[model samples]
Target: MIGEQGDGESVGTSAGNKRCRNKQQAGKDVAVQGTNDSSIVSKCSMASLGYFNDGFLKGFVNKTTRRAPLINRGYYVRAKAVDYSLHCFLQKTASYSQRQILSLGAGFDSLYFRLKASGELENVIVYEVDFPDVVQRKATLIKNKQEFMELIGCMNEIKPAQMDNLYLCGLDYKLLGIDMTEIVDLDNLLMETGLNPACPTLLLSEVVLTYMRDASSSAVIHWAANRFSSAIFVVYEQIRPDDPFGQVMQQHFTHLNSTLHALTQFPGKEAQRKRFLSEGWEECHCIDMNEFYTGFIPEQEKRRIEMLEPFDEYEEWHLKCSHYLILSASKGDLKTCLSFHPPPDFHAIKLDTFDPLWICVSPCEIESENPLLRRFAHCSSLIAPNIVLISGGFGSRAGHHGRLRGATLMTKSGPVWKCSFVGNEGSIHLLTERMFHSMTSFCDSCCVIFGGRTSPLKPVTSVLLLKCEVGDGTISSISLSVKEIECIGTAPSPRWRHTATEVIYKGQRYLFIYGGRSPKEMVLNDWHFLNLEDYSWADIPVIGPTPESRHSHSACSWKGGVLIAGGLGATQIPLASVFHLRPTQSGFFWNRIEVTGSFIPRYSHTAHILDDKLFLLGGVTIYSDSIPEVTLIDLKTGQSLDYHINTNLVKWPVMLHNHSSVLLVKERQVLVVGGGGNCFSFGTHLNHQPVLLQLPEIK
Candidate 1:
C-alpha cells in the first residue's frame, strides 16, 4: 500500500534507508519541487515559531517572518494538546517510579530542552531520532550554541564524529540518526541508547508517519507495540482528505511534491484508531483537533489566549482544526499506564433522575460504640490517616455544645467507625462554643479551626488548635490549644459559615478565608489570610470582578487556587456560579468560571478533590429540600456530570446543611457524616448514618 510514486518497490531495510535518503536529498537536488524534506521540516519549525510568538512557549526565538494570528493560535492549540498528552503520560508513570520518552522522526523539536529547562526531566530519560543529515545539522547547531549544549549538561565539546548517535551521560538525553522504516536499525539504536522495554514509555510521532509508505509506518507501530511492555504511542497528523477543506489541504501538500503517503491510506479518525487496534495495541483513541480545542483545553486558559490577537477566520479555523487529529494507542495496563478514556469508575448521584438500579454503600455498622451527640454545623478534619477529629456544634447533649472528639473510620475488611473524646479527662476548655466554623489540617498532627458562631447572634473571634497522637493504628491521647491571630491593620469582622483552605506559598503554609455571614446578619465578601508561622492575619485586597457575598458555600484547593462553588448569594438566592481565587503579586484575583453542562445551584454542600475531579455531594437546593445529587467536575477539561443516588441504600437525608466529608484516599471513597434535615431539625438522622460514597480509580 505504498504511494503511487513507488508502489512496486520492496519494503526492505535498505529500500527504506534509500527512501529516507532520497527524501532528504530531493530537497536540495530539486529546488523547483514544492514538496521536500527540508520544506516539511521548515513547516514544523514554523509551527514552533508560532507557539513562541503566541506566548504559548518561551525561550524560543523566530528568525523568519511572523505568521497570521489564526495560524499562530492554531499552532499554539496543537502544541498545547500534544504537551498535555506528554504530561499525562509522565504523571501516570510517576507512580511506577521510572519513565522514559522516545520521539520518532523528531526534527528540530525542542520538547526535551524545554522540559529540562523547567526541571521536569530530573527523573526522565528522553531520546530523539531523525535522519542522519538532519541529526547532523541539529547536532552541529547545538554544538555551536552554548545555551543549547548547556541544556544537556555538557561541559565539553561534542565531537563531530560522534554526532550521528550519542548519549549525554549526565543529562539522560540521547540523540540518534536512524531510518525509522528500517526496524532492525531502529531496534539496534534503541538498545544501544539503553531503552528499557519494561519501563513505562511514551513514544511520540508528530506528522512523521505521513511521509512513509503504509507498510513502513505500520511496521514501526508494530515494532513499538511488540517491544515495550508498557507504552503509549501518540500520533498527530492531518486526516479527512475527501471533504472540500481536506481536499485543499491534500492539494497543498501534493503541490509541494511531498505526498502524504500514510495519510492517504488512513485518512480519518476511525481509520487511525483501527490502524492501531489492528497493529496489536490493546487500546486506541482518536480525536480531532476541533474537539480537543473546544472540550479538552481548560476554559480559562483558552479565554486568556483568545484575546492575544484579533481573530476572524472562524470557519477556516474550524475546518483546518477538524482536518488534523491526535491518536493514542496503548499496550499493557491501559488504566495504570496510558488510559485516554475519562475515568470509567465513578460514583455519583443526581436529583432529577433517581434511578433505582444504582447503589450506595450501606451505613457503617458499629457494635457497642459511644457515638458522638446528634449535631449539625459541626466541623471535621482528617488529622491523620483513618482518623477524623470533629468538634463544636449546636446539639442537645449536655456536653455537646463545646465538645471536641476524635473518630477512627478504619478500613480493614470494611469500614469501622469508632469515636473517642479528645483532650485530658478534666481539660475540656476550648476557645468558645461554636458552629459553622472551618477546620483545616496542618503540620501532620495538628488542625486549625477559625471563626464560627457561639450563638445565632454572636460570632467568636478565636481560633482553636487540636493536636493529637492518632496514627499507628491507635489514638493514645489528644491535646487542645488556642491562638488569637493579631492583625496590624483592619481585621475582618467575625463571621460564621465561611470557608477556609490551606495554601502553600513560597515554602510556607497559610490559611485563606472567604465569604460568610457577619454577626449582624450582613453578608460579607471580604477575604483574609492567616499566616500559620506567626499567627498573624492579613486582609487581602481582592482584584478583578469578585463573586457576590455568600455563605454556606464549599471551597477547596485546586492548582494553587481556591475553587468556590454553590452558595447563597447577597440576594439570599442560591447560586450555581463557581469562582476561583488565584494568588497574585499584588493581591488575590477572582475568576468566575463559565462552566458548561447542567449545574444545580445549592448551598451547604460538601466538596472534595479526588484525583483531578471535584465532587459535590448532598446540599440544600434553592427549594429548601436536601438535594440528593452528586456533581463531578473535571478540573482539567471543566466538564461536569450530575448523577442521582439510589436512595434505597438508606433513606436519603432530607437536608444536607452543615455536613462534613472526608476523602479516604487509599480506599477511593468519601465518608459523608452528620447533617440537618427538615424532618429532624438540628440533629443527626440516625437512619441515615455515615455513608461511604466510592470514588473513581486512582490514576
Candidate 2:
C-alpha cells in the first residue's frame, strides 16, 4: 500500500515537470516564429525596391517597411542565392518525370506562388512544413488571397476547423503542420502526404534548423539523409560566431530568444560542410555570401542592383556577408548538384618563415573626459609637436548621438594625453558636420579641409581653411577658427573618401587631391593640383595611364610625390596595387610599383611614410581570417612584410577600418584614434579609447 502511494506521487511530479517544460518550449517556439515576420518584411522591402522579381512576397506582409540600403543588399544576396540553388536543382533533375521540394519550417513564404506564376512548377511539387499555429495562419492567408488561390489552383482543406494540422492540400503544393524534430511522426506524415522516397527531391531550410536544440537539429539532418534516395539539401544560416561581428549577430538572435545552435560547433563554411558529410550525406559544399555573390552572380546583375539605391556602407555589407553562409549537401544522383567555385581572390598565401614581426598595442590612458574620442571615419591631423586635432564624424555627446560639429585637440604631456573640445565659441558655426573628409596640416597653426559628405546623398563642396591660435593663458589647449576659401579654375567635383596630400611642384606647395566618390559618380580617378599660395587649380602637363579609380585608399606624400596604396576598386573588390605619382619638372606621372611579398588586398586603412617605408595600418579584407595587421612596404627595395598586432596587450576590440591613425615618428608609435563600424543589424560600435601601437624595426 505504501509503494502504490509513492508511485502515484511520482507520476504527479513527472506530470507537473512536463507541463512546465512544455510552457518554456512554447515560448521559445513563439519567439522563433516571430523571426519569420521580420524576415518576410525585409524580403518585401527588397522586392518592393525591385531588387528581385517577386510580386507574391508583397501578399505575405501586411505593411512593408523600407529597409536601409545595406539591409536591402543583404536580403538581395540571400534571396538570389536560395533561388539559384533551387533553379540549379531543378535543371539538374529536369529529365526526371517528377521532382519534389520540401521546405522545413517554412513560414509565410510565397515560393510556391512565385514558381507557379512563372510556370516553373510544371512537374514539381513543393511541401512546406512549419508549426501548427504558423501553418494554420498561412493557410488562412492563402485562402483569403485571390492571387495565391489562383496560383495554388483549388486546394482542399483537411479538417481546418478541428485543427487536424494537415492545413492545405493542392495538386502541386502541400502545407503541413508538422514538428520536424519528431522524425518518426514527421517521416510517416510526409509519406502519407505523397512524399516519394525515390523521387528527386530538394530540401530547403532558410534560417531554420539553427533555432532548434543541437541534437534535434542534427536529428533532422540525419533523418533527411535517410528518408530521401536522390535528394539535395540546401541550408542558409549564420556562421563564425566568435568574431566581433559574429558575436553581435549571435546576440541579436539570442535577444529574440531564437538562439543559433549550429554556430558553436560549425563555426565556418568548412565546418558546416563537414557536419553534413558526417550526417550520412554523400557530398557537401559550402560558401559564404561574399563568395556566392562574387563568384556565382553575374556582373551585369550586380550593376543593376547597385543602381537601385545610393549605398556607402560597404564595410557593414561585407561583414554581414562573411558572417552568413549557404550550404548544399547531396545524396545519390544529386551529388554534383552543388559544387564549390571560389572567386579569383579567395586563396590565401602560405608563409615560409616561422618568425613573424609583432607589434604591441595598448589603449591610451587619457587624463581628461574623452567623449570626443568616440567617433569613426573622422580626420586627425598632427598640427603641432605635441598636439593632434580631431574633427568631423558621426558620434555621441552627453547621451545625444549625431554628426559632430566641433573639433577636439589632444595635447600630450609626459605619458598622459588630455582632450579639450574646441567648440563654436564664436558667433557662427565654423566647422560643418561631416565624415570621411581630409584635413591636411600645412603648418603648426593652419590646415585645409577638403570634400566630405553629411550622408551618402549630400557631398560637401565648400573648402574650409582652419587656423589655430595659442593664447598665453594655457599651453594645454588651443583655439581654432575656420574660413571658407574659394579657388580659381575648374575645381574637382564634390567628393568624399578622397585623399589630399601635400605635394611640392617646383618648390611650390600644393594640395594634390585624387580619387574620391561623388553624389553623381561612383568613383573618380581624376587628380587636381591645388596651389596653396594662390588657392587656384593649376594645370600640369604630361602623365601616364591613371591608376584604377578607387576610394578609401591610403595616400601619403613621399619624396615630393604621393604614394597610393590599396583601396576598393570599381568592381567592389579590394585592390592590392600600389602607385606613385612621381613629380616631374613639367607634370606628374603614375608609376606602378611591384612589391615582392604576399600582400593582402585591403582598403579603409591609414598610411604613413616613415624612413623610406610605407606603413599600412588596419583595414578590411574579405578573404582574411583575422583583421588586417600593420604592413610595411619598402619604397626602395620593393619589398613588403606584415606585422601582427599583439592583441593580448590590448583591452578592447580594435576595429581598424574607418578609424584614423597618426604616425608618432619620435615615439615609434602609431596612435589609432577612432575606429569601429555599424556591426550589421547588431548595433554601431565605437572605440571607447585610442590605442598606441609600438612599431618594430624591419629587417
Candidate 3:
C-alpha cells in the first residue's frame, strides 16, 4: 500500500508505455474501490503505520495501526530525511524575514499540522496541493477533528469551507485542489492564494513525480524553478529500477496498479542530479539511503534505533537502502542551506538516544630549548609530580654513551615542553653507557634504575638511585647516587629489557623485578625484590603456572601486585598473552588473564595505569611495522578496546617501540619520548623526537 501511487489525468501514451500506464491506472482504481480513497492517500496511511511502529510518532496516530518491521524502518528513514532537510532549509534561511513551504501532491501528510504544533510555522506560509477528491477527504477529516484544527489556530472558529472543490485557508496555512498535469490551473491557484516569488521557498515532493507522465512532471519542475527566486527542491523516491531488489519493488507497485513512470526515466542519483541541473537549477546533491544512513544520520541515534527491533536481514537491508535516495536542488542563495552535520537542536527530536563516546588525540606544542636527539630503547620515570627523568638509550648522538636529562612538564604555560637539565649539569650520571633498561619511581624524591646492556654481549647488574628536587619552575638539580644493597639471598642475574615496578607491601615500600633476557641472551622468568627501607635484595619464589620467559615486555603496579603484558616470547615472536602476579605469604602467585577483543601482539611498547585501567601505547607488532594505537584494557573485566590517534591533526611518530611514556595524571595526557624511526633494520638507523598525546576523559 505504501509503495503504490494514484492515477492522474491521462496523457497521450505511446505503444511502448501503454502497458505501464494502464496497469498503474487499473491498480489505482482497485485501491480506491477497496479502501474508498486514492491509492496515494492509502500510501500515506501506510507511512503513518510505519511511523507509529518505529516510535517516531506516538499517541499522535491511532494505536491499532501496524506495519511490518522492515516497512517501519523504511518509513522512519524517509521521515528522518524529510524532517532534517526542512530544518536545514529553515536554519540556512533564518536571516530571511519571509519564507514559504510548498508541498506538491501532499495527501494526508501531517507535516504542516506537526510543524504548526511545534511552533516551527511562525512567520512562515505553507501550501499543500493535491487532487480534488483527495483534498476534499483530507479537509473533511481536519474539519471534524478539533485537535487538527487547533494546530492551525482554527479551533472553535466559524469559517466557510468548500467541500466540492476542497479549498481551506487558515493562519499561515492553505490547502488547495489542482490536477498536477494542468500547469495553468496550478499556477493560477498559487497566484490567487497570494504566492510571493521573492520569498525564500522550500519545495517537497515524496514519491509523487513517478505517478505522472514524464512531460507533466518536467513542466511542474520548470514552473517551480521559474516562480521562486531563492529556493531548494527536495525529492525522495526509488532508484535502481533494473536491479533485482528494484525489480521486485517495481513488481509490487505494478501488482497494486500503481505506475512508477518517472523512475524508469530517472532511475538513479546521477539521473536525478542531471534532472535538476537541466531544469535550470544552479546546484544539486543526490545521495542514496545507504549513504544517508552511514554518513548523515547521527551515529548516536542510529545505534539507539538499531536496538528497537530485531533485525537479521542485513544483506537485504543494505540492498533495500541502496535502492532509495534523497535529491536536493537549489538556486540563488539556497546553496549553503543544506549541511549534513547535525545542528545543536538535532537531539531534541530523538527520544531515548545517547551521545556516542569518542576518543581522539591531537598534538601539543613543545617549547624545549633544543630538539630531542633521535634515539630508541630509552627509559623514563616520573621524578616529581611534573618532572620526568630520561636516561641512556641507543642514539646517533656523540657522547660518552651514558646520558641523563630532565624534562619539566609545563602547566600554565599552555602546552609547552622544556628541557630542564641534561649531561653533567645534573647532579648524577649513569655509571656506564647502557640501553634496554628499566626505571621506576621509588618515592616523591627518588627513582631506581635497574639492569641494562652496555653492548650486545655486555649486561650490568648495577642499580643507581636518582635524587631530584623541583626548583625555579624546573627540575633545577638532580643528584645521581649508587645504592649499595646488601644481599640476604641470591640476587637476580644480569639482565636487560626487564620490568621494575615500585609497590607497597605491609605499609612498606619495595621494588619488584620480573622477566627479561639474561646476559647469556636466554629469556628468564625469575622474580626478585628489594626492600627500600634497608636496600636489601631477596629472591622471591614463584608459584602456579609460570608465564613464558620473555624480554622487552611491559609491566605496571596494580592492586598491590604486578600486571605484565606483551613481549618477545619464544623464537623472538611478540606475545599477546597477559599475566598477573599477586604477592603471597610464601612467594608470589601467577595467573594468566583471559582477554577479549582483537588484541595486537606487540613488544617494546609502554603501559601505564590510569583510573585503574591499563593503557598500552605505541609499539611494534608482528602484523604492522609500528603501531600508533592506544589500547585500553579493563583490569577488572579484561575487556579491551583499541583507538588510533588522529594523525590528520598531529603528525604520527615514525616508530612507537623502544619509547618512553609517562602519564601526566592531572592533565590526562601522555608524554612519549624518543624512540626508533621508520626502518626496523638496525643497519638503517633513524630516531624520533618526543610528542605529547592528549587522552580523552574516560567517563
Could you estimate the TM-score for every candidate? 0.46, 0.93, 0.46
Clashing residue pairs in all predictions, respectively, total 8, 0, 3
Worst 10 residues of 3 by lDDT: 344-353
Candidate 2 stretches with Cα past 4 Å from truth are 1-24, 157-163, 344-357, 471-476, 649-652
lDDT per residue for candidate 3 within 121-151, as digits (tens), equals 7678898988777777678777777777777
Residue 548, model 2: Cα distance from true site in angstroms: 1.2
Top TM-score prediction, candidate number: 2
lDDT of 3 at 154: 54
- Better lDDT candidate (2, 3): 2
Which pairs in model 2 have colliding backbones?
Answer: none
Model 1 agreement with the true structure over 146-256: per-residue lDDT tens digits: 667787785334433433465333347787876676788778777866778998889998877887768778888998999998899999888867533454566556665
User: Which residue pairs collide in model 3, if any?
Assistant: 27-257, 367-417, 428-480
**Higher-TM-score candidate among 1 and 2?**
2
Residue-level lDDT of model 2, residues 421-468, one tens digit each, is: 877777217687888899998955778999999998998887989887
User: So what's the TM-score on candidate 2?
Assistant: 0.93
